[model samples]
Target: MEDPKRLEEGLGHENKDRNEQFSEKDDKTKGGDGINHEKEETNTVVVVEQKGDHKQLQQQPLVKQKTKRVATLDAFRGLTVALMILVDNAGEAYPRIDHSPWNGCTLADFVMPFFLFIVGVAIALAFKRIPKKRDAVKKIIIRTLKLLFWGILLQGGYSHAPGDLSYGVNMKFIRWCGILQRIALVYMFVALIETLIIKQRQSVVEPNHFTVFTAYQWQWIGGFVAFLIYMITTYALYVPDWSFDVYSHHKLERYMVKCGMRGHLGPACNAVGYVDREVWGINHLYQSPVWSRLKACTLSSPGSGPLREDAPSWCRAPFEPEGLLSTISAILSGTIGVHYGHVLIHFKDHSERLKQWVSMGFGLLIIAIILHFTDAIPINKQLYSFSYVCFTAGAAGIVFSGFYLLIDVWGLRTPFLFLEWIGMNAMLVYVMAAQGIFEGFINGWYYKSPDNTLVYWIQEHVFIKVWHSERLGTLLYVIFAQITFWAVVAGILHRLGIYWKL
Candidate 1:
């Protein structure tokens, strides 16, 4: 029998095992009257041999059993992680793919929601059969705590900038929220909701257009409730004028901005920033936001350059991208992911699952377009707007369904096998690659000057000189050097059965 304790990785954890009893009859004419039957749990194949033939049985070779898993899920996760590394490393040279300054969506914007959506899907698969609710909830809490701990240690101003050699962070100005922190919050709430409403998941399959919604109605209701909370608070909350201190040219400067608005969605007067400032403290928020690259804030519109001489007071105020009020809408993204995951679980046929996913995906996209075109709620990633949730979640559904069609149904997993390796060990890739830990370590060994390092040399000489274009060179280096390198690293780890789980 294969080892029951096999490792299956994702954004979080996903493990499944089933036990059943069965009997198999073999031919009784193999030079013996009786049969030597071997049976195991979970629909394993039975190998029959001669009852009194020890020498013949000893000559048999070992056979390995493969674990059942959704190959599309791992491939999708790997694609997302690979995108994260691309944007994080190459966004400086390529501004269009980077995060949008304020009001629109970009390639970088999809990474966060993709992660949250993956968490929701993973939760559906992970909690498919929870015999003990108490133990499951305990595990969820522990995983959430672990995510929060790593989020703070890695992203909470504890480490220096990628270029800076210094270490340590000021306790007063350490950020309290980040990418992993947001993921933790979304995971905890969504997992608890799914656990409480586990009874709603239908046991029998109903292959209808609306069966997915009907089966998990409570989850949609919870998602709607969260949406309403965010909408109401964003529209009704009164944002007072705020001020913050910034150190410019070795001098402490205080700047004030006038708000006194109810529903201002500007970079400075937004309710999301107001809530984060009030709850987490201005000093504890993200100091450098992508919004600083806005034309009104800096001379450069998309690329980050010097601040404009006539920049507004809010330009200097720190704003948390993963703020508190904005997280409500993010929950809706997770809820949509749970819906797609439910489709995977309830529908056995490939066509049926794709139909459900396509229907939901198009429905969300239409709603997103209506909202954005009508100016009701423009798709804004920084705020995690309602339309943003619908747009990103819808896109995720369509993409995942496509992956299923290609990798799972069509049986073409050869090209995407590299992505599967990264997906299986996504947590390790996140820490080592996306977080720049690996690059920082490599940068530690320099020849003469502090800037003379292997990574820098490759980017400057091998990539930059080959193309004679900074942007193109940086993009290619990220694709080949970082993304491809990590894929190989993850592949090796998967081969060795090494996974760093939260």
Candidate 2:
């Protein structure tokens, strides 16, 4: 009979030595036929080969572990939020720090748009983690509703302590629309487009070689559409008759007159208050009785000390900074932020060359040039001009990219810990500061020494006394009060482990 070992050895040179060894072992244990043992051994070899193949199949890509530090993005967001708090709560907004009046760009102008943009970046990051389409849609709806509800609450749901509105004829209508409300509206619309519309379309296609362009192509298209729609709406409202000279028509002024005539004169007898009447169209659209009731109250109090009727309506124009038309530009600003986040995530592995930085810098420079020429697209925060959007977005992108490089790429984090800490609980600080939660505690009531009560002394003596000659100093004093308030609030929030989420 042919030897089983010899037959196995003839299969391959490598197998010959392995087969001889196995045969020797089998002979020592000889409780069965050699051919039966050889067959069992061969089956074991096949099983081992299959197990090895399975291990290789289960291995994940190297990139999975490497790309997990999304903390950098969160840190970037925190920095932006911190800057917002700083600017919003400046000790003294010297011309150097404050935004330009209406025509030019400034550091202050970048804060709001940067916040919105960061929101967009967050939106992009969020949709990826959610499991089902229905759940995502539900989350989007809930978030939008909560934002709107809180926005309205902040405007004046609790403007007066419970029964304060009951005082003989004291009714104040807090302006209906505001920053948070606008953010809610825009976010809702964007989320709807991204989740329900865009994702549905993407699901129908083949899975393997999915392109980012096809998936998020709608964001770009939608951004453009938003810009165009806003621009057209603003143009029509600003110059209803369609005259070449935008100044000739003054559609806003005309609208104000129409609003005033309708007896919906709003809070103060000023242009901004009047414009609120037009935008809210509260009487017509929502059937809001607040405007009409307030008007009646004012008329009833004919002899009351100068019932706000004589206040120059134009004075309200400055208050227009937070208004309807401007919100359009704000939404566009968020879109720009979304674009930046996309680039950062997608090109993380690309060469970190000087050319990439320079290219971004140049792109911003080009935008600045275009803004300089297009005076028609005024850089007005109140109007939310297209030029304002371009200038703010460009500046914000440069700042964000610089911070990303320094903190994330270069690993320089320790130096910015305090700022980062303050940033982490930013919204908490803002609400606390805005609500005067710590004003009495920090604003000099606790000080034993007369001179040590810096805030009190400044407000009563230096600000009201020594600086009495300059109006600017008084404004600066208010800013100083705001800053001191924030510092105390930041310290407290840091200690409490309280981080406010939106």
Candidate 3:
């Protein structure tokens, strides 16, 4: 009987020897003691063989036909969604959890990019299991539209109807750009690229379950081209001289006359903002985009539409950070994720896979740092700046790599079940939380009166009293309640055997 170690050997070498080593009968039957695992949960699978009466283990594929998800990706996604809920809820309590006022990355800023990256990785994995479905394009288009519809319906920053069940859907002043809208558009674009242009390089006849798309030369070509497109478009388009003076129209005109940037091609005067304003109209843009306010003008509150036309000159009109043009960069973030996905599924050696992630992750990070310091590109989330995506994607790569090493390589799954539960039903939680389902359904009871709100009451009595600070208590409660509440809900959902997608 062959040693079991052969079953766990590198797929590349073992597969190479299969034709000469095994007879035709070897391929025909499973025989005894040679059952193969269908789950591609780890980097390797143990294949077994039979010779005469002696059943023996032999080389196996790293992944099987089904390609069940690697637990690490689920953990990564869960952690990302969990943090998103935390920061979104914490905005009122902790200033640090809030997004940077204008041009820098924050813990909050990292969430969107990482999620986009996860989408890319998931795309690679999903396609491997079921490529070229009869309704593939139809499914892609439908999914894309659903995401877009939900984005506009729930997060479009439209006002509600007065004393009516129907939403206002106010066309006169509805914001077109939003978190989910950006996600939908990005996903559609990437999926189209995968389905039509990139073209999967797989071996259909051989039927090696472990084999995934190499993408090879095309991967680098796609990435480089995406970068070029973003950089050129970011800089080449013309933008008007922005007015900083909110009140004195005459002063603004005068300042525009002499300001060096007025006629210059600056980022503040780029094509992205100009096009968005024209298409969506200033009144239809995000009201609370991270922008500078001056001359006693206050920032617009969340969910508000664009500034009034009559607003003082100092009140900056909203410009979407996730605007149309920056979406190209967003797609690039997903592209990088696809590359990592290739490494994960195609590369069988754990060390080789780790090396690839480290190189890709650090390479992007270093390039981002260089571009930022050299002013080749700025790290601005508002613009979805080129450098910003590079940095975020880099961090995401390193993070997932670490999780894969721990959970998949070291076989540590039980420790992260809490995160796994949340991850499996991430989209459900996100949409529900975004639409005020949590607050409307659950918090309504808690906040009916001062006595009923357990979280606030506890904070007021315990954390505040012990810490001797109201703000500190509120911050602590914000972190604790969000994580705990969601984890419990996710746990129950997991136990109920429900998985939500799209």
Whole-model lDDT values for every prediction: 0.79, 0.47, 0.61
Please report, as a residue range, the 10-residue window in candidate 2 with the lowest summed lDDT: 28-37
Q: Cα deviation of 434 in candidate 3 (Å)?
A: 5.2
Q: What is the TM-score of each candidate against the true structure?
A: 0.88, 0.61, 0.74
Number of clashing pairs, model 2?
3
Query: Residues 39-109, candidate 2, lDDT per residue (tens digit)?
Result: 11321212223564473323322321111123344455556655554554441334444554345565667
Which pairs clash in the backbone of model 2? 91-479, 91-480, 270-313
- Best-to-worst order by TM-score is 1, 3, 2
Off by over 4 Å in 1: 1-68
| Candidate closest to the true structure, highest lDDT | 1
Clashes of each: 0, 3, 3
Q: What local lDDT does model 3 show for residue 143? A: 76
Instruction: Looking at model 1, report the run of 10 residues with the lowest lDDT sum.
Output: 28-37
Better of 1 and 3 by lDDT: 1
Worst 10 residues of 3 by lDDT: 1-10
| Residue 217 in candidate 1, Cα distance off native in Å | 1.8
Off by over 4 Å in 3: 1-69, 129-134, 158-169, 197-223, 241-268, 293-315, 443-468
